[model samples]
Target: MNADDAAADQLPLIDQEDRLMASLVPLAGCRLVEVGCGPARLLRQLLQQVDGLECAALEVDRVQLARNRSEPVCPGLHFIEASAAAMPLPDGWADGVLMLKSLHHVPLDELDTALDEVARVLRPGGWFYVSEPIYAGALNALIRLFNDEGVVRAAAQAALDRALARGRFTAVSEHRFAQAVAYPDFDSFEQRMMRPSFADHRLTPELIAAVRQRFEPHCGPQGARFVRPMHVRLLRRR
Candidate 1:
């Protein structure tokens, strides 16, 4: 990882203006949209740090959308429930778009359509920031025992590359970093990951035993600590 990559590894946890990628993102007084925004955690952080940020949080999961709607927030924030392949927003709707750790979650068949939607929603010269988890590392090894995402993740990267070649967007920058994933124990890992809001994971006995066997070696007095590799692509709307 380069200096910027190292700094961005702590992107979500702390408010490091320099490391938060404020320079690459749209400046103040711009509207932003986040596809698959989930709980709007990153949107909340960006709104607090960036000046005059109007964000549209989009999610395909109605459950997550409803949960976010119940929470109170400023009027500048809006929530929309929609799939990435078919966003409800109008053309040229936003100055910037974000898909953090969410693009790969889009259905594999619709990945290209989702990228097209991203390009459609962004105005000329607008920015799109996409961050995806690299399918490797100790944590991933444990998870692959039951739910493997190698194929989908590879397809997601291919879609991004194809977008660049299609001439709708220009790849301005790319960065790779690592984020720390700490679990108090195996139970915490299972609860948080296996039952994630988007997908259901069935952990058969054999799968459970495999995960336990692989995860046990990493367990320490405090817990298990693993670093997940991350790849980020910053594209400018052409």
Candidate 2:
């Protein structure tokens, strides 16, 4: 399916962002803030579930912010165009903070300051949750092929560890979740792989094509399948 068709069919629901929001439903009554909320997909869902709850999303990309603004926003959902390191909200203003599929994009040098901002915005006893990809062994190879391996991997884990040591949060939980992606044919698989998000990496188009060709036969009747493993960490402010 083309990108537009896939989007229309809600195929995007299979991504990590959707899963993270589903996981956070238990924290329904709390006021929530999401950093790096690309397109505010999860933010919209959260607004739908929690009645009278306030939710704010901080997105750095002006283009994305403009698109989100053009969409019909829920009364409880608010969007702010800003960096994660400097949110406009007051300190300790949120009952929960979420960073999903976004920590990896943060620069390593500025990560500490960003985490501090997250901590500052979260209320005492509030929850801070982050879900990101961890590069382990072969996974590092795959990620490096597409993007900055060392920086993305290290920054994600560093943010987690640093948040754990902040003393403001307790009972930190770290776990991994996996999602499956299935492609119906080589054409579809190729299209998905070549998306701007994945293509900018170091992996050459030829290499990706070769890998896809070699693996296509083993993909079961579903055409092609790959497991995307995600790391999730949850912490409650003390």
Candidate 3:
């Protein structure tokens, strides 16, 4: 698995992507939509895994969404530039929905709306898969040097819990795991995770230096390795 996956914390999210897709049996030709699909990478993976599955992706970052849309279409793949709280998809349009480590990125005030939107799109008995990065871990410690996600992460979970309380969907599964994010060197990590264009984490020169100082301690002969905690919630629309 690459360092870009958001679902991996204790278990390898990429390695188990196929397993997760296959677990949704009898869905060979089902329609699925992913909210907050960064670059639509998971969508591509699912398309490859589930033959004849119609897939759609929604991304708040227009840059990433544009790039993803420009990629050669894979028959049933579609990409849209929109936020989770305000997707353009029609109600009851999807058989399932996936959110991979992205709910926290939604604006705090709009989180519940986004969950409502997920329910709106999913047909009754459809599934909603949510994977989020937990707040405690070596990776979180290091990344907090530049961008701290504590508040948003907690907010995301609270939103998920509140959604569950409404009883519109029934919880089917809950999982937790950790995964290793390997960087050949500090440069790679800086480029990929530190100043990623998708987020608003702007690093100043001083902050960059601070991050370097914090990150250097973890670097070794094989480069830096970080263990990130992840959590997944599988729910079914009732």
Candidate 4:
């Protein structure tokens, strides 16, 4: 029950990459792996901002993986087609592992396996940084209309708690922050949110109208700006 756990609109809007870098002050020269990296946007930012770091971006989606590989490669950066539950990386290969808004997306039955895989790949005392979107706020409400994540998100947290309880990892830090997402219009929102390459929500005609009905009210002269509450947990592999 942290303060930012609530739908607090007043929370400072931050470039999450800045916060991530600040948290990962020791990241330079480290071997980092980002599991379930859809576009590796954050990884790209890190590769540019930090020096001497080797990063591997793992994605399970074929379409997104192909697109990532097709893109121009960054120095000290590579892409791997892999899943969080069963990473192809060798044991003790990573100095840090990241799961950004993707843990809850793992099959509920495989949540523990994914966490264990993270622990397996990470060296002793390596960092495990996980960021999950809180299941609250107007944006969550709109998204829930099509893809409700309440149960899976809770399960994700519970799995972490279980891992901590078992002494597989030690809690190093926790942070809560807000990131603002703006959609120029409903069309933009639909294109980005509803039609992602990962999961198929099966958007129907009636469903689209209903979603639009709820989303339109949030629009303004500047379009829709929604605060996405994010919870971050930094753990160390024991």
Q: Residue 227 lDDT in model 1?
A: 73
Model 4 steric clash pairs: none
**Best lDDT goes to which candidate?**
4
lDDT of 4 by residue, 1-238 (tens): 2354454566556666545655654877889999999999988888888788899899999999999888897888889888889899899999999889999999999998999999999999998999999887889889999999999999999999998998889998887778889999999999999999998998999999999999999999999988898888999999
Model 1 whole-model lDDT (C-alpha atoms):
0.82
> What local lDDT does model 3 show for residue 67?
81
**On residues 1-238, what C-alpha lDDT tens digit does candidate 1 reach at each position?**
3554354445344223225568666558888998998888877877777789899999988888889999997568999988899998889989999898899899988988999999999999999999888776666767877789999899999999999999879999987667777899989988887777778787688877778888888999999987777778899999
- Give the CA lDDT, 0 to 100, for residue 33 in model 2: 91
- Which of candidates 1 and 4 reaches a greater TM-score? 4
Which rank order by lDDT, best down to worst? 4, 1, 3, 2
**lDDT of candidate model 2 versus the reference:** 0.69
Clashing residue pairs, backbone N/CA/C < 3 A, model 1:
none
Lowest summed-lDDT stretch of 10 residues in model 3?
1-10
Top model number, TM-score: 4
lDDT of candidate 2 at residue 187, scale 0 to 100? 67
Better of 3 and 4 by TM-score: 4
TM-score of each: 0.88, 0.75, 0.89, 0.94
In order, how many clashes per candidate?
Answer: 0, 2, 7, 0
| Winner on TM-score (1 vs 2) | 1
